[model samples]
Target: MEHRRLGDSGLAVSEIAYGNWLTHADGAACVAAALDAGVTTFHTAAAWAEGAAEEALGAALAGARRDDLVLCTGVFWPEGAGPNAAGLSRKHLRASLHGSLRRLGTDHVDVYQLLRFDYRTPLDETFLALSDLVRQGKVLYVGTAEWTADQLAQASAAARRFDVPLIANQPHYSMLWRVAEAQVMPVCAREGIGQFASVALAQGVLTGKYRPGHVPPGSRAAAGGEARRSVWPLLMPDLLDRVGLLRGVADDAGLTMAQLALAWALQHDTVASVITGASTPAQVVENAKASGISLDLDVLTRIDQLLGSFVQTDPRLTWSPPATG
Candidate 1:
């Protein structure tokens, strides 16, 4: 797998990162399989499964040389009682990082990201707390997940003011979710920060698996009781037709929709990495295959037209335009 310096930071991470936001219950083998396949970067959050994910990841990576892989972890979600247990306060960050360290079986983490913006806390305090982590040697670099363009700019300013390196961002960017394109992407490009695009497959919908009468047994739609089916709910005929058109594009390229989906995002020079959450090893390998493939202009233009077949005012997405064509 190809590796890149995360954002402008000196640290390097695999283009595809193994994420375990679900099903850490039996993840050691899965994580090991991913590591064996050259997926050396792992991303997890403190809120996933109420601390169980970090514990599971810790057990999974135990004894592996630290330099062999990069462990990316996060904080900023409510884990328990009391106000101090959540948000970007120094107290919670300290508590969470210590907890994460113990769970990941490491003295320090390669990257410690805030899961999202904490409006309750002042940007100054949150930025400083993260800065302090870097200064104290507990966190190699500080990053934010799902942060807006404004937040990124403010945080960048804070990093400059404090001399802390805000190196990366984690955001939802897929054929199904493209809000980042409207702002976040440009900010990262201008700021010299890495954009780690997560859910690049859009919960497997962009894989072209769900059909008019079929819901693949192993898909995330069936992983649990997912309410949001594909962006085009199977019940909607027009959207299903659009999906078929998208699949034809993938077929012509000899790539699965999933691969094309990831490739489209990786096409961005600003994207530092794409973190894919997989419940199985096969998925890990499939995601890794998308790393270096670049979609041609004609296909990308068709993808836009295909997606443009539907429009909604929800503002949850920004239907991807042909980045190449």
Candidate 2:
């Protein structure tokens, strides 16, 4: 697998990071497939399956050297009934990191991220807590997910003051969703922060399995749960129609729709890694191949022309928490 520097940090992560968001049940076999494919980074969240994700990941990676993997987990999701159990406050951050470490059976994670920006917490408090973790050798680098341009600037400033490593920002990025280009990319490019792009397959829509009139049984959207809600906006007939045209593009290039979409996302310089999910080990192998295929100018232009108006490039579409409660 190809490797790139994560933001301005000295660390290098696999271009394709194996993520466990909805695939917690896939367990060690799925993770082993990624490892065999040369995926050194494994990303999960404490909130994923209520920490079962971390436990499974820990068991899977037990045989590998700790220093060889980039293990990442998140903070900020409500872990309990306590008022301080969720936000970026020092208490929650400290408690969460310790719990994550214990669950993962590791001393330190390569990257510890905030699941989302906590508008209710002061930036200084969050940054300082992260700084303390870094000093204590619990978290090597800090990152945030779905932060706006303004929040990134403030985070960089805070990291500077705290003397901590603020390395990456994770966001949902796909051929169908280009919101990051206008809202997060420019600032990240300028500030030396890399993007850990999630939803590279648009929650499986970009896989071309969802047709205009047909919703495949057992598909993400058809499941009628969190995945459905997450991908609800992109479920329109117009978008699916445009997606169908990409089948020709994929056929011409001898690639699957999933590979085509994944390759498209990795083309950007600001993207450090394209995190992908798989329900099976074979699926992991298929997704990993996208890293080797580069979409030349011609194919990219063809994609743009095919999906022209269907692409959502508006900066405002990039979601951020409200500045105040």
* Top candidate by TM-score: 2
Query: In model 2, where do residues sit more than 4 Å from their true spots?
Result: 23-25, 322-325
How accurate locally is residue 140 in candidate 1, as Cα lDDT from 0 to 100? 84
TM-score of each: 0.90, 0.96
Q: Write the per-residue lDDT of candidate 1 for residues 23-50, one digit (tens) a residue.
A: 5544777787778777888998887888
Q: Model 1, poorest ten-residue lDDT window?
A: 316-325
Q: Give the distance in Å from residue 161's predicted Cα in candidate 2 to where it truly belongs.
A: 0.2
User: Could you tell me which residue pairs clash in candidate 2?
Assistant: none
The most accurate candidate by lDDT is 2
**Tens-digit per-residue lDDT, 1-325, candidate 2:** 8999998888999989998876446667898999999999989988787888888888889998888999999987777777777878888889988999999999998999987888888999999989989999999998889888888999999999999888899988988788889868889988889999999899888999988878888777787778788876778999899999999999999999998989899999999999998888988998898886788899999999998888888777666563221
> Residue 23 deviation, candidate 2, in Å?
4.5
- Stretches off by above 4 angstroms in model 1 are 24-26, 223-237, 309-325
